[model samples]
Target: MSIVLIDSGLGGLTVLHEALQELPHERYLFFADNGNVPYGTKPKETVRSCILSAVQELVTEETKALLIACNTATSIAIADLRRLYSIPVIGMEPAVKPAVELNRNTGKRSLVMATPLALKETKYHDLVNRLGDTEHIDSQPMPGLVTLAEELEFDGPRVQAYLQETIGDRDWQEYGTAVLGCTHFSFFRTAFAKFLPPHIELIDGNRGTVRRLQELIRGREEAPDSAAAAGPVVEFRHSGSDPAYRERMEQALDWYRRDRERAGRPRA
Candidate 1:
């Protein structure tokens, strides 16, 4: 059985990339709803519908688990999807809990950078409220970053300029942690590191999400229906008919691979 990862666009590749490192032998089916890209800025109902439609298209008897890798989609449709599916349905959330913990006693706040719609969702708010660190948590809408990532604009003058315009004015010293609430934002880690204060650390939920997936997969490893491939394989699909999206996904994966290698962390 294949593990399914769904997102509106290329953002979920970040999570998929992480999974590749840890679950190198697992089969993966990555479904990108490229036809309805940028779920972040869309209406809640519209985004939820798009996510459900994509999930419906991807989930099958051969699917072992489902991961909603987009923060916006997770915020809007994860609960409904979980109710409808018996598979291990995992969803992404901002790494707010860890970020808050990191900032504790440091007199520094944790900044959450995500899409506007995600930040507006009650799920996001309730997460923050439940943490009971409202005073030390701040959120910024980064819809433009999603667009840039979809366009494969990782780091360049345009990306730098956009980052500067969006967050340059902030008092970086007041923030000890920056939670990448959107998966797309992970692609811009280089740009953010160059722009944000050196003291500010970046955090994301990809690792945690992948850990949850590993747990689910482990639980089913001995099941009678469990299937294993000769090696890890990733099948990329999208809602759009364009073949270019497949190439784009490959390119993004290559970029991530090269980036990790440069950081002395080669793929498993």
Candidate 2:
């Protein structure tokens, strides 16, 4: 069986990266709505529509679950997805809980940096209220970070400038941790480090989200040894006419391949 991962763009691959690390035995299918990238700024209804359409197009009977890897989409439509689909529906959230926990004992402040909708949505507000100490949780809405990730500028002057422009004014010394609320933002960890102090930890939901997926799979019957030994295979689909989108997807796959080879892990 295969599991489906849906994202507004390439950002969700960060989650897919971790999923491959933790659950190498499962088949993974990824779908990106590049035609409508950056769901952060879009209207809630539009995001829901696009997500529903993607789910309808990519999910099949062989699919075991749907992982919504976009933070903005999770904040807006996760519940709707769970209700609409029969299979397990997993979603990502900013790692506010872990960030808050990391600072709770010391009474240090923690920051959650995300898109405007994620910060304003009730899903995040409830998450902060339930799992974190509200007093130490600071929310920062990053407007253009997603677009920068979409542009694929991983390092150098452009990323540095973008980080400096977005977070340069913040009192970086005060926070003990910063939760990366968007998956795209998670990809620019080095850029974030240039602006943040060494002591401030950066956290994201990728690993935790993948682990939860593992836990959900534990309840089901195991795949045959032949299937498990075959390892993970990622099938990609993009709902856009842009050739650049396909090229970007290929680049991401190649990066993963090279990293795995460097680590001496067996290829799928």
| TM-scores of all candidate predictions against the true structure | 0.95, 0.91
Check candidate 1 and list the clashing pairs: none
For candidate 2, the per-residue lDDT at 45 reads 89
TM-score of 2: 0.91
- Per residue, candidate 1 scores C-alpha lDDT tens digits across 207-261 of 8999999998786763232344455688999888798999999999889778767
For model 1, the local distance difference test gives 0.88
Candidate 2's C-alpha lDDT?
0.82
Record all residue pairs in model 2 with backbone atoms less than 3 Å apart, i.e. clashing: none
Badly placed stretches (over 4 Å) of model 2 are 221-228, 253-268
lDDT of each: 0.88, 0.82
